[model samples]
Target: MDTRDTACPPTDSAPVQPKDFIRLIVEEDNRTGRWDGRVHTRFPPEPNGYLHLGHAKSICLNFGLAREYGGKCNLRFDDTNPLKESDEYVQSIQRDVTWMGFNWDGMYYASDYFEQLYQFAEQLILKGKAYVDSQTAEEIRTARGTLTEPGVNSPWRDRSVEENLDLFRRMRAGEFPDGAHVLRAKIDMAHPNIVMRDPTMYRIRHTPHHRTGNAWCIYPLYDYTHCISDSLEGITHSLCTLEFENNRALYDWVLDELDAYHPQQTEFARLNLTYTVLSKRRLIQLVEEGHVDGWDDPRLPTLSGVRRRGVPAAALRSFCEKIGLARCDNMVDIALLDHCIREELNATAPRAMAVLKPLKVTITNYPEEQVEWFDFPWHPEKPEMGTRPLPFSRTLWIEQDDFREDAPRKWFRLAPGKEVRLRYAYYITCTEVVKDDAGNVVELKCTYDPETKGGWSKDGRKVKGTLHWLSAAHAKTAEARLYDRLFLEENPMDKKRHGKEFLECLNPESLHILPSIFIEPALAEAAPGFVCQFERLAYFCVDTRHSAPGAPVFNRTATLKDSWAKTERAGLAGEG
Candidate 1:
């Protein structure tokens, strides 16, 4: 996921205790010996789709707080919807959470509490706090009312407690079709908060659950299952996004009516990154409609997508740290995320030469069949990263964009008759340019200065430009994918404000494929998922899903440039 808040090395992130407001709250609670000085949190995600970058915020916050407070955090799958939830989503969620560098203290699913939840529903009916409602889905929505008006009472609102229990039990016994009847809390129909207006606790769905199979014909809704599951597990701080602020009341009402243990429901702003979408239904549509390759497509904001794109777990964590915590919603700049990515890769990724748009360069004065090797360091700043033997030959490849037949003023790259340093090798001056029948420049003929071997002149003649090159004889051709923001607009969702759909705002130039990229021979040893810098270019990772043995594909993780720092940036916010 593209993001601004996150951190590296889970160990580097722990500071005796992280000082966010949430952690401060935990600290204050501990000082008071609340809940006996115990802190328990949970990440309750609906397992219907792959977890996206927005989920990463909650993951880090919950997991990070648990680590700081010496408490435990559970990975709970709120699998309340059978039709949409599945084992595929369940496994993917686990993988994504682990990829983000967190291991849950307890792994569970709401389906595990199905029996207890059903019994609780029955108990509520026995006390007249809840009852079976025979209203159709449409009827219920209409009667639920809007913010300006209060909802009228349901026709069956006054059903006797015994009759409600019998109908609910029969509903669970497979006597009802889907949506024939529902179990709802018997709260006030005219309550100011519509969510607490007799919210449905259970609904009939004969469909088999991913984990429970056909063992259950009725399933509890999220609002009911969430609170009870928290109480049952003894969670002390039930953290949720600010959007769930309204549902907090419903969460408490159920637990209160049952007199069950209550967990404090605290809401924080959800992560919302620019130029990205995190809606599960919309994300699924993008995949199913062939808008993206799959859930792991590098262009997507999915954790798998970012992982495939070569975002390090540490970088994401570092981003979380940069974003910190916010009670109010904000739009975080994608540039800030790019800034973090570039910073992490610059320090860690091994540097290698690559020419995405290869322009052949032949040295006229150099001897044929002659080759020289330079002991090139993997990183210029850190000697500990070590070095590799870089091959140099008479014939070489440079980036086509690096050269200009008609050079611009102050251009520090290659041009005809201009001398420039060929990194790790000699200084070459362009003497000739060759073009195809279409008048497109295809090659350049240059003469290397023998005195400038090892990319330096004994006379100390400084060259402003330094270009990365690969020996034409040894360099391997690999595909390089350059990805950009998925949407041209900063907030794609805002397209609706213009009477248009978000899909129409797709950035057509989001992905560029250079299938004939030439890289340093040493890159042959780089395995899939190994991230490295294409010197003077973007940091790229070996594509894990599309690469084959002896042939690798590179996906651009981030550019070397930091737009956020170099320019005035705005709409800096987190995801929801």
Candidate 2:
């Protein structure tokens, strides 16, 4: 679902029409006075799962189009399937769209049109265009033969209008068990189009609806409900992904037969990204099986999850805009998505030093109780962002990975007798290595050159490497959650030699929790949802649930270096 090319909002411009084929057609239609110069769009999502990056693209397209044309977009939930839909999902979806910077003209639900749809079904039955079939569910499926064969008509296909009406009313009255009887359109049984072979219009589902709450037992099928709902709303264009292309004929036929206002259905390729799965069912499985924490796990493609992970809506929108709309589906490289966040954060996030896996460094010559302040620029590109004072002391914490006891050739970081610059602080040389009883290098004893204060040498001595450090006394404890790819396989759905489910390929090390991270004390004051770069580590944002006034919890949004760039560079060098 996360793709670089998406229909993101205009990051830097007045509203302009996108150069996609759909827009071009809409433009021509507008020029020719289509819909009387009205441009109304609706983003209809089924209230079953959290909206993912896929929904974000549709949201941008629908809402973005409305914004450009000075029209209004409606937020509609296709909550026809009460078995899966929830009020929680409806509310969450509304919040997510609004958070993405879209204002809905109105709120709507497919259930709102149930009464009108029921009347339409009765009219169809009266006109001999529809019939109530008494065939069992399995019998009906068996009758609806394979693609190469024609389906057999139900034995009760010739039921009179009065009989059909009575049976349908009884079905609605809960007289039938679930799937006992169904209403199907009396369409061509010998039609080449499989959908035209008397598709089901209504099925008996005695379950209580999320909204209606036991108002009726018979539920209208999607094919019967969607087009009628669109017609009721007077949607100018029923824009949807290409997978629904097969249903387009059914959508058209139902409206055409009813002599109702028909909205034009246009299909574009859906968004698919490599190394990620967009299917909500699969996502639900991951969550239910404890493969992921929840829908908003940073590793999830869900909008709330990504937003919680510190990806700006503007960046995601920019990615969607770049991807554009196409007539055919394609798998986008996940690198593009990583690049989008990197592009945005580089310009915006304020940088701060944090030491994960802290290695204690003690300056042997400096006074132990003395603390000096160094002026550190918040951001390099934005000077107006100003500066914050970082406290430098004799005792400091550096990244454990930034030192070596036995230095390799070309190693530029801390080592015995080797000098390195503490970023924005001073030049330091490792004098001794403090090891544990088990011979594990636990800490380093270092001495700083007073002449090289504030990372500049008075004698112009060269230090090849610079390391980010924090004053141990001024450091705050935090929990940092490092996230990696959810699936190890580029395409998880590929069921090859391993006769295992996609869950089997779930990356075991996808999420790593570092419980005792040492960040600057300034970060302790940071509120939930605050975003900042951890100097040399990565972009991180405070977790809203776990972060509070005293305890700060950070989630690694993305790495300092782009992993995709490494792949591309390797590709250029002809490496596997």
Tens-digit lDDT string for candidate 1 (198-310): 99999999999999999999999999999999999999999999899999999988888899999999888888888888888889999999989999999999999999999
Model 1, runs deviating above 4 Å: 1-18, 568-576
- The TM-score of candidate 1 is 0.95
Superposed by TM-score, candidate 1 places the C-alpha of residue 365 at a distance from the truth, in angstroms, of 1.2
The lDDT values for all models are 0.89, 0.87
Give the lDDT of residue 21 in candidate 1: 68
Best by lDDT: 1
What's the C-alpha lDDT at position 170 in model 1?
Answer: 98
User: Of the candidates shown, which would achieve the greatest TM-score relative to the real structure?
Assistant: 1
lDDT of 2 by residue, 100-170 (tens): 98899989999998999999999999899999998898998899988999999899999998999999988
Q: For model 1, state the Cα shift of residue 235 in Å.
A: 0.5
